[model samples]
Target: MCRWLAYSGTPILLEELLYKPEHSLIDQSMHARLGVGTTNGDGFGVGWYTPDGPAEPTLFRGTGPAWGDDNLRELAHSVRSGLFLAHIRASTGTPVQQTNCHPFRHGRWLWLHNGRIRGFPTLKRTLMLAVDPELFPEIGGSTDSELMFYLALTFGLERDPVGAVERMVGWVEEVGHRYGIDHAMQMTVATSDGQRLWSFRYSSERNSRSLYCSTAVETLRTMYPENPVLQRVTEGTRIVVSEPLGGLVGAWQPIAESSYELVTPGMDVVGRFNPQSAQAGLPVPATVGANGG
Candidate 1:
């Protein structure tokens, strides 16, 4: 329902990805090629870590379309970061307010999501109750995406990113099923804690939203030796997106369904995700032959 991109590599101006590509995130704001919605114009936001500035990332958000935001264009031209996240929203029954924009921040961490909880209105209260009381006050928006972030935090995202998210999804699905919902989850999410980036793709129905990560610079350089753009980035440079930024063949790889990828300094990781682990301490799934997502 929305579009987003996460970049980790040699520092570069935000425009390189937000505007320069033929199918950039800003372009996706108006002409998304792969999202469930053709245009993600409800709102937008960008968060970036300044290596020398603060432990927390800098965030700029707006309640209007990303493509029409002059402030966004200005910042995109001037702000440079090695690690950043950008998102353009397509509201799924949520109010269009600044606080509801993506790349939501909490201290050093930033989180965003694409896709909806199939029956969010019905599932909200139960899921909200699961959030830690201490962290609950920090929630400034009413979107399921933001709630998912808090739920992950409550489940220990600060210590274990993958496990925390799995628990979050499992808890959501568990609650949804108890309410007689058949498919309880659908999402492709990205979250970063200034140092590393973690991304996930999964849906209760098994056919989730789109998610992709950039091919390693070395691999791409070897394949397209004459491409000047490949020369600008370092070996550690990587990008994760709802869809490819450009039509460059072999420059992007699809993350499989029911999986996740973690991008760190040295070796990156890809792993199979299992929500069954989440059901351990939670209520058992009820069998009324119903579902949610």
Candidate 2:
């Protein structure tokens, strides 16, 4: 499992989202309130885009706990961006290596996942065989989460993100079921093209890992009138996270299961996900049985 956050809108220092909150992602790295584990210290990563740079994002990832990393604190304070994705990892079985860290990058895209493939060793070979060869060499990690990212890319995630992701999940579940592993895929993924952000929350089982998004800045300002930080953000800013970074009640909303949310230049759009099946070529079933049984 892992903890992550994605931000889109007005440019702000990374610290504002990764450290300033009372229970920020760094805090969750040591004391998560809702994650299966209390700590997500296996490794961490952050990706951001700048105005003058190429469309590709700048990324920093390390195989160390976010809570104890001095470099992380220093970098968080100095970097600022209008869009970014940060992740704190809790390795399920993968080794704690830089290549295995989250916020995996491709050409102009960055991706991170918060869940796992229930039986990765048994399914990895098959899944790896399915990725497009041109995109295959770019994969730098052994994590199933990273594999899923490339699979979606191979399936055309950059062009039709929601469709591509749904297809990737469908393939995951299909392979899991083939191996007699029910509900083998669990995920809350955030992906960006240095412009728009797309996030998905779903598992073969109906009970997916927790994922949330912040309320509109204007709404939060009205709800917590006395909070000065809320006042600083513009009306269009939005944040999506694996958990609420702070204890600000009403500041976050759970994303619906079997759906995806899109964050563009000025607005956020959410809709149900329906991936066309690779086999039947029709909408695939996104539901899973209890406990993946």
Worst 10 residues of 1 by lDDT: 284-293
Runs in model 1 with CA error above 4 Å? 277-293
The TM-score measured for candidate 2 stands at 0.93
Question: What are the Cα lDDT values of the candidates?
Answer: 0.90, 0.87
lDDT of 1 by residue, 1-293 (tens): 99999999899999999999999999999998887779999999999998898878999999999999999999999999999999999999999999999988999999999998988898887778777778889999999999999988878889989988999898888878788887889999999999899999999999999999999999999999999989988898999999998889999999999999999987799999887545444332343223432
Per residue, candidate 2 scores C-alpha lDDT tens digits across 50-151 of 898777899999988999999999999998899999999999999999999989999889999999999999888777877777788988879998999988
Error of 2 at 81 (Å): 0.6
**What is the Cα-based lDDT of residue 281 in candidate 1?**
40
